[model samples]
Target chain A: MKDIILIGSGNVATHLGNSLKKRGFNIVQVWSKHINNAKILANRLDCESTSSIKQLKKADLYILAVKDDAINQIISQLKDITIVHTSGSIDIEVFNHRVSNYGVFYPLQTFNKNVDLDLSKTPICIEANNKKFENKLMNIARELSRNVIQLDSESRRALHIAAVFACNFSNHMYTISEKILSESNLDFRLLLPLINQTVTKLKDHNPSEIQTGPAKRNDKQLIDSHIIGIKDAKFKELYTLISNSIISHNE
Target chain B: MKDIILIGSGNVATHLGNSLKKRGFNIVQVWSKHINNAKILANRLDCESTSSIKQLKKADLYILAVKDDAINQIISQLKDITIVHTSGSIDIEVFNHRVSNYGVFYPLQTFNKNVDLDLSKTPICIEANNKKFENKLMNIARELSRNVIQLDSESRRALHIAAVFACNFSNHMYTISEKILSESNLDFRLLLPLINQTVTKLKDHNPSEIQTGPAKRNDKQLIDSHIIGIKDAKFKELYTLISNSIISHNE
Candidate 1:
């Protein structure tokens, strides 16, 4: 069995560690900048834990699941290990001249530390420097997920940006909706079915094709009412901007 | 069985007609400003179709599923036949002076003509002036959906605005995501799994609690990179505005 070491204790690291352990991969060590977090994650997977880079034991694979900025600083302090990052935006070239073999093992899904997700169906995007190392990473990734594919750094970067709009910005829209409902003493729960159906529809149709609302219909009166109804200046500005965008995109 | 005459043949009208017909309700007639639309929907439901209000048959219920602006003009031509309008934002009292027994039977879900929704779990918000008519509408709504509840005009309006944010604006985020991916020669399909997981996470936790990405982290560097990377000025502004909102909301 190939031994793996996780280098972070955040959402991604926690999830990856758990899923890998479930798949019967030997997770040899877990490390984080904070000893407390490292210990917490390590205990769950029954692995060795450390805060210091010097304490990292020799493993077949080192997964750098740290923040985008922290990757450079952390990678700078270590060398000569087959490594990969789980970042969406950062280029694979960051490990150039620093490590003998490096690649990316980005899982394109939102992770929550407390929530348990079955990584089997989640898309595992892989990238590697050399053909041999690429095959190694692919073998391990296939063990964790059925949807493993080779994705280059350039395409991965584009996917990350698109993700910001789809997942992050989309969730922000939910937050804004919650805020709007709260102001009127209405329960946010009322919109849950609507939100679910919005996504459920996408399972069959393209989003641009299924787009609806005052903006898509160009119902000027309704759009104006919504703009005036939104009390927050920032939200109102967003309402106008997004509404106009929807109108234009549909046209 | 309640003999219903559906006004307008738009998304809501079409879906409502189909679901009601499936529930064994008698859809006696369908009407629209355009005869073509009315004929199309009416043919599907196996009902009489008309472009003229004078041609509307006498039915137990007249569901004015027309546009919000068109409601007043359409209602002006007909009265005193136990009517209801399926609108979220419009006042229930809009029917108070005109009809003897009128109510609101708003289905709180985004509708598409081609896609058939079960409506079994869909929340149908109802409002009426009297208990007799209210109960009558409730019975009908219950036949169509298990999630029938009484929500007044004020709360419904609030919920409508929130739906615009959650359903409409959130879908716009998908459109933007697709646009970004298309520009990079990346298949929008890669982002579908991510989008699915984003919504899937919400089934267990609050959106604010489960929120991820650079904005939630308040990672200045990553956010700056994304802003610079976004070629569209409007999208860039949205990125900044929404990123700031996420940061503040979390803090």
Candidate 2:
């Protein structure tokens, strides 16, 4: 587990590679289909860079950190190395016992290469085929993050779905908010305090329990006004759908 | 103004009342339709308390921080003093020129009385009938918050609408996430890192610009898998709706 190869050079790979390298794991190789992508991350990790999959160096662990579809293609090309992926939605069965040891090392955090992240605070979900490998993977995951959990494939899938609702859908709401504010020349920054408080509240309370607004209050009049003013068909539909969902959850 | 009477005793009222009191404003009286509510806030402010509208004290500024529907009823009872309501959706025209002094002092933040808040970081949206009073309201708002703006009814309404999408709708996303995780006996806290990162990213980029998910990547197979797994009719519908919305936004 001390020697590692990070198989992607995107945001997730960039963050994880640096974090693992910081924890004194030797990032033996950085691999991407594009030489430039591999070179960029390799430069940061001070490791060997490669666009050639067949040229990959043997390491104790090879993190298959690539696109979900690309996982199969890359894994099939390698032999006899422990492999794990950093995908929330992908199944652990993707390994199909290709090697003696394989697992999933999905970090439950959104990553942007340009943005700073405290990997120690992020939750890492680990899954392996056997107890021995699971312990090894857990130790590696624990080295980078204080929060690590051993999750099975089914539970990981459920968690991934929940992550979509919490992170992706929540961000879509912000997209819609930015659109609405732009129409009236209002700065998006005006909503920062309110946005900050919304997430801050969840630290202690359930989302439905602290829910407020016309939808939660079941104020039909206010909801009606919000729906009527929306000119974008998609946004209007979203407004009505979500407001009704909130009202339903309240009931 | 220096002298103020706070009408209402909810989260907004409690926060605004305490903030104004701390700023050295003389709170002549705290009034709520319920005597207990008035007494509770008054005890905290160390001021006079009243439930009777007729017993409301005369002050340089009267902040009518009641529910939106109750504004007209409460204002019809107050006379010969400056009046302002702290509502996001309600138009300032609700004042109807009944008094020489009327305005709105809407704070653009979701407040919880039990939660500690830094009011100076919150935005105060003020609107008044006359420039003299607008300046006065602005000065008072500035005292409480560094982020204060004199917004008109139309723009204020726009900002309010945006807040609903940003705060209320985003929280609803968390509600759905909690519901999904509960079905699998998974802890909701597992999603916090992802949730925190989602909001934290907005400080540097627009939501639409930073969007990343199956839908954002236009991965139809992943989206289909998610939609198919949802058992709740409302959630299934919501998943499809929001996914399509994200896809449409990406295009």
Candidate 3:
């Protein structure tokens, strides 16, 4: 059995650990700076939990599912094992000169601890220092997901930035949409069909090719009216900036 | 059979026209400023085509699916007939005293004429000059969609603005993501899982409650690095502004 020590107990860690557990991987322990978080996730993962890095058990794999900035701190304290971090932006080279075997096993999907997501459908981007470890990581990734791809450090960095724009920033747009609707006692659920259809259309072509709306049509009169109608300065600014961006794309 | 004349041959007009045609409604004519556009849609709709308002035959309903600015021109030419404009932001009163029986039939979904969409699931927002006409519009809307909503002009306006943020602006975010991926030779399709997952999580919670990323986490380090990494001035501005907005939401 491939024994694994899943580090971190946040959304990414919790989801990845549970998904791995489902595949019959023996998770030796779950580690986090907070003992309660580790314990909570570990209990659900059917594994041991620890707050201290010193108490972490040696396993076939160490999945460093910690936050981006904290990655270096955790790396400085571990050695002599095949370790991988689940991050989109962080470089695989962060493990250089510190760990004997290090790579990246990044699943390119948004994670929420409570949300049930099929991690197998997510695109896993993998990278490693050497061919043998790369193949090993790819093997594990292939077991978990159908859409696995090899991406270098720079490409992964680009993918991460793209993800931030596509997922995080776009999600903020939905948040703004909900806020706009609330101003007039409208239900956010009313926009779900539009939202779902927006995503569904992406399967056909590039987003830029299929752009729509007043901005795409260069409806300056309607755009101006929308801006004037918006009360918040930040939203107004966002409306204008994003609208202008869309118009520029049309040109 | 109740006769209907669909005005305009654009994305909204084409999709709604075809969906109505499928429901066995008698579409009498397709109208557009350009004769070619009118002819193209009329051919697909199996109806007559006209470029001049003078050539428009009287019908039970005149569906004005034209652009916002040209609505006035189209309305001035018709009278003593039930006329409805398919716009989110436009009020039913755009026909105030200009026409006898008027209403609004707004389908709150992004439309692409070339893309296949199940219009039955789209939420059709209806408003009218009178209760009887409202019911008439409601009946037509109900026939095409399962989610027919009666929104007074004000709420519909807010919903329209929200739709822009949720659909149009969010799509622009996807466009930006694809542009960023192109910079590093990464496939845009790789980000689809992340993008789709972003929308999926919304079903379980409010978008603001579930915002994730360096911005949501307040990882100033990652945000600053991402800003530094972006070469385009506008993209950098978008990155900083949206990140600040996400951070603000977290607080």
Candidate 4:
């Protein structure tokens, strides 16, 4: 069994630690900024917990699942150990000097600790400095997920940006929809089936081809009427800008 | 059996007609601008097809599933028959002059003629001038869906605008994500799991509370990095606008 130490008890770390534990990988330690967070997750995985990097035990692999900003500081404290960070935008160079073997074990999926997800279905994007480290990381990734691919730093960064539009902006659209419904004394639950249907349609069709509504039709009358219906200046502005963008993209 | 005439061959009409047929509603006639389009649908329902409104058979109910713009012209040709247009934005007053009884039977879901959907799961928003007509439409709606709602013109219009943002804008974000991935020689399929997870999160958590990404984090450096990475000026503008909107919404 490969011995592993998990750094960071956040969403990504918690999920990864639990998944690793289920796969029979020996997680020796878990470290977090807060001792309680580390202890909570560590207890669940039957591993040791530490608030300090110095308390981290030696293991075959150290997975840094901390924030993108804190990865550099945490990397400086570890030395000459095989390590990987689960971040999409941050490059592998952050681990270059401090570790003998370094790579990226980024899962191209959103993680919410409370939400139970099938990690095996998630696409894990891997990057490493050499073939040996790559093989080691690939082995661990394969245990957790069926979809694993080698993605370079540039492509990973691009994917991260695309993710912002797909996940973050898309969620914002839901927020706006909720606001609109509530303002009219309607329930947000009314939109749930429609939301599910929109995503379901994409399984067989390209999003570009399936795009619909006033914007895609370029129906100025309906567009103007929709804008008039919106009371919030910010929402109206968003409606216009996104509408124009869709029109431009289609053209 | 309730006799009905379906006056369009588009996505909404196709789905609604098929669904009503499944429920044993007698569809007497199908009409469209072209005979071919009308015949295709009419054949499926075992109904008469007509290109002219003059050929329309008198029925207990007429479903005007045509475009919002063409509604007035079509209504002008019909007289003293109960009719309802399946539109989200248009008011029931469009049928006020030409018919003795008229209403709205708008289904709050996106439809594609080729795509099969459970209309029973879709929410049907119903409105009419009188309680009798309202009851008439409600009976039809109940046969097709469990989620039947009596939403007035004002609320329905707001809901329509909200649907544009939630469904259309959200799908465009997916299109943008696809463009970004394809540019980097990455498969758009890689984002599928991420997209599915994004929507799945909403089942338990509110979208505003669960929104993630650099913009939600207010990470200026990462947001700037993403903007710099975008080559298209239009996309860059969208990135900036949406990021700013997310920040403002959070505040």
What tens digits encode model 1's per-residue C-alpha lDDT throughout A12-74?
Answer: 999999988888889999999899999999999999999999989999889999988899999
Q: Whole-model lDDT, candidate 4?
A: 0.90
lDDT of each: 0.88, 0.90, 0.89, 0.90
Instruction: Please write out the lDDT profile of model 2 over residues B1-251, one tens digit for every residue.
Output: 69999999999999999999999999889999999999999999999999999998778999999888788898888777798999999998998889998999999998888888989999999999999999999999999999999899988888888899999999998998899899999888888888888888888898888888899999999898888878899999999999999998888
lDDT (tens digit, per residue) of candidate 3 on B1-251: 27999889998899988988889898999999999999999999899999988889988998999889989877877757778899988877788677778889999998888888899989999998889999999999999999998999888888888899999999999999999989988888988878888898888799998898999999999998888888788999999999988888788
Residue-level lDDT of model 4, residues B118-228, one tens digit each, is 998899999999998898889889999999999999999999988888899999999998899889987777888999998988887778888888888898889999999
The collision pairs in model 4 are: none
Best-to-worst ranking by TM-score: 4, 2, 3, 1
Scoring only the A-chain of each prediction against the true A-chain gives TM-scores of 0.98, 0.98, 0.97, 0.98
Error of 4 at B208 (Å): 1.3
| Candidate 3 segments whose C-alpha is farther than 4 A from its true place | none
TM of each candidate vs. truth: 0.96, 0.98, 0.97, 0.98
The 10-residue segment of model 2 chain B with minimum total lDDT is B72-81
Residue range A99-188, candidate 2, lDDT tens digits: 888889999988788999999989999999999999999999899999999999888888988999999988999989899999998889
Off by over 4 Å in 4: none
Instruction: Give the range of the ten consecutive residues with the poorest summed lDDT in model 3 chain A.
Output: A92-101
Show pairs that collide, candidate 1: none
| Candidate 1 C-alpha lDDT tens digits along B1-251 | 37999998998999888888988899999999899999999999998899999878899889999889998888889957888999988888887477888889999999987787878888999999889999999999999888898988888887888899899999999988888889878777777778888887777666777788999888999899888889898888888888988898888
Cα lDDT for residue B80, candidate 1: 74
Instruction: Give lDDT tens digits, candidate 3, residues A7-58.
Output: 8999889888887888888889999999999999989988899999998888
